[model samples]
Every structure is written in C-alpha cells, then in structure tokens.
Target chain A: MLIDQIKTIINGENVSIALFFIGMYGLCARRNILKTIISMSILQASLVLYFLSLSFHPLNVPPIGADLNAYAYVADPVPQALMITAVVVGISVTAVSLTMFVSMFHKYGTTNWNKVKKKRGEIE
Target chain B: MRRRVLAVLMCIVCFVVIIASNKVPTSDDLPIATYITKNAFAETGASNAVTATYLFYRYYDTLFEALMLLFSIIAVIYMSIHEGDKYDE
Candidate 1:
C-alpha cells in the first residue's frame, strides 16, 4: 500500500515541486561546487520521475498486441516520448555545469564560491 | 542581532507552513496506482511501467542523459589532471 501510495505521489505534481525546492536548497545551502552539481542532478532526476509517471495506466497490457476492446486501460504515450528528451538534456546540462565547477576549482584552488570570487578579484 | 532573530522566525514559520500543507489525501483524488497499472503495458511494451516510461519511450533521452553524465565525469577528471600538471610546471 505504501508503495502504491508512493507511486501515486510520483505520478502526480508533488514530486516535481519537491524536487524544485530540494534543488534550490542544494544550490543555496551548499558552499561546494560539487554538491551544487549533485543537487542539480537530483533535480533533473525528479523531473524524469515526474514525466515517467505520466505514462502509466492500471491493468493495461503491453502495446505489443492485445485485445484493444477488452482492455481496461490504455497507456499515455506522449509523456514517455517527452521524458526521453528531458533525460538527455538534463544530463548534458549537468555535465556542462560540473565541467565549469571543476574548472573553477582548478583556477581558484578552492570550491567555495565566496573564496573563489575573492580570488578572482585579486587576479584582476 | 534583530535581523538574525527575524530570519530565524521567518524560517520557522516557513517550515510550519510546509508541514501543515501535507495533509492526508482525500478519496476524491485520482487513483494513480490504478491508472498506472491499467495503462502502463498497453501504452508502452514494457512490463514495468517505470522501465517502459524511461527506457522505451524515452530511450534516446536516457541515452543522451547517460552520455552527459559521462561527459561531466570526464570533464572533472580532465580539469583536475590539468590543474595538477600546472602545479608541477
């Protein structure tokens, strides 16, 4: 029952809202660039979960070959199609952001944003 | 000191608001479990709805996402390695 409840929650809008807040918390709370990147990844995963949940329909047979008329449910294909694109884009964005974080760490010798900013000012 | 106290009070109020809003679900809300179970297999060819949603319909997106994660790892490693080389020089 708990699993079912969780499934329901994921399928609904709450997961997306939760992820958005959590991601914001990570971005705002963490001083380390790596943690921020990890948080961003988590945020992206939330969206993936949200989109994937939309494709479900109870008691439906796989779309391979079934009695369409007798079937009690039909799956939503559009969300599934859209989620694939979201996953890929999320990955690319995470990759680029992390790359920038790593480069910043290298240049400043510290991952803390405040220190990095100070160091950049010194360099200029 | 006044600003710090105000900030703490604000944080507590926000926390309380979030907690209060998460009430028990009513019966009228849509039964997502039933919906998922009914449509999952018929819409996507996967037995598992989660798998079907992620791998089948969104396979290309998943593929690119994995690639992007790989790219991040590579970039981090590259930057660190380059930083080390610069130190040696």
Candidate 2:
C-alpha cells in the first residue's frame, strides 16, 4: 500500500542522473567511435531531462489566454525555452560528429579509437 | 579495468554531490520567472510563452542557436559530399 502510493517507482531526476552516469560509462569504457556518438546523445538527453524536470510543474497552466483561466499560475517558461535550444544543438552536434566519424571510418576502415590512431600514424 | 573502476567511482562521487547540493524541488515559481509570466505576451506579441521567452527575452541565444544549426548542416554536407583524399581505396 505504501509503495502503491508512490506513483512512480523512481523519480525522473534520479532516472536522468542515472542515465547521465550510464552515458559517462559508455564514453569512458567504450572504444568505438559510433558508440561514443551514441553515448554523447545519451548524455545530451539526460541533461535535457534534468533541466526540463527542474522547471516542470504540473498544476501550473500555460501563460496564455488569461480570459480562459485567470486564476491559474503560469509554468516557468525559461527551462522549456532553453531546452528547445539544447535539443536542437544536440541534434546538430550529433550530425556533425556522425559526418566526421563517417569520413574517419572511410579512411581507416575501423571505428575503434586506438585502431584509427594507429592508422593515422602509419599514414604519416 | 582500472579506467572503468575510476569512471564508476568518479560518477558515484558526482552523483552524490549533485544530490546533496540541492534539496527537493518546490512547486513555486522562481522570482525571476515572474517577469516572463507577467509580460511575455505584452513584450513579444506571442501567445506562446516559451516562444516569447526565447525569441524576445533571449534573442541572442536564438541567434547563436541558428548559427549552430547552419554550421552543422554545412559541415555535414561538405564532409559527406566533397571529394577529399581517399586513403582506404
């Protein structure tokens, strides 16, 4: 009954924080360039989640149409606005990184960082 | 092995620090948010509050964001299409 009262098993913040760590693990432990890109995306998503959660409030209404609901409080617009930029920037970054990775993979025929490094050395 | 262990340790430390540095979130709005809530539509002429805040309140940010998008598109197209040195052929 006590657990039933808890609507969510884990808080959204905790989930995002955990995802942040998982992304970090992928960045640190993995060697593949593509995997690194995926990890970076995970990292971005986690940050987006964190900020959106920071400003999130359910009872608050949208800051529009005062005649519709004059009594309702407006939700904080700052985080939501900022997160839009963040999401776009994240997509842009991922696109750029993928393009770079594609060229590197084409040149080196491998995705592992160490292998790419060795190939570059041989080229020089 | 050592690197993985270090990463786990570092992440755990950061996680604990973040959780400890803040208290639970309150439903009340921050003082700075009052400006956006009260005057967003009046100042920006937009019914959407988020649109007003980003476009008018933080126009500089929007400008830079547009640049970032443009640069990324250019970079992807150039890198993918341009005939550069081919080493693996």
* Candidate 2, A34-86: lDDT as tens digits: 99999999999999998877666567776664332354666778888899999
Question: lDDT per prediction?
Answer: 0.63, 0.81
Q: Taking the tens digit of each residue's C-alpha lDDT, what string does model 1 give over B8-38? A: 5554565456545857654442355345545
What TM-score, to 2 decimal places, does chain A of model 1 have?
A: 0.75
Q: Where does model 2 exceed 4 Å of error?
A: A1-9, A67-69, A122-124, B24-29, B82-89
Model 2, TM vs. native: 0.83
TM-scores, all candidates, are 0.54, 0.83
- How closely does chain A match the true chain A in each prediction, as TM-score? 0.75, 0.84
Scored against the true structure, residue B45 in model 2 reaches a CA lDDT of 71
Instruction: Give the root-mean-square deviation of each candidate in angstroms.
Output: 7.6, 4.1
Among these predicted structures, which one has the highest DockQ? 2
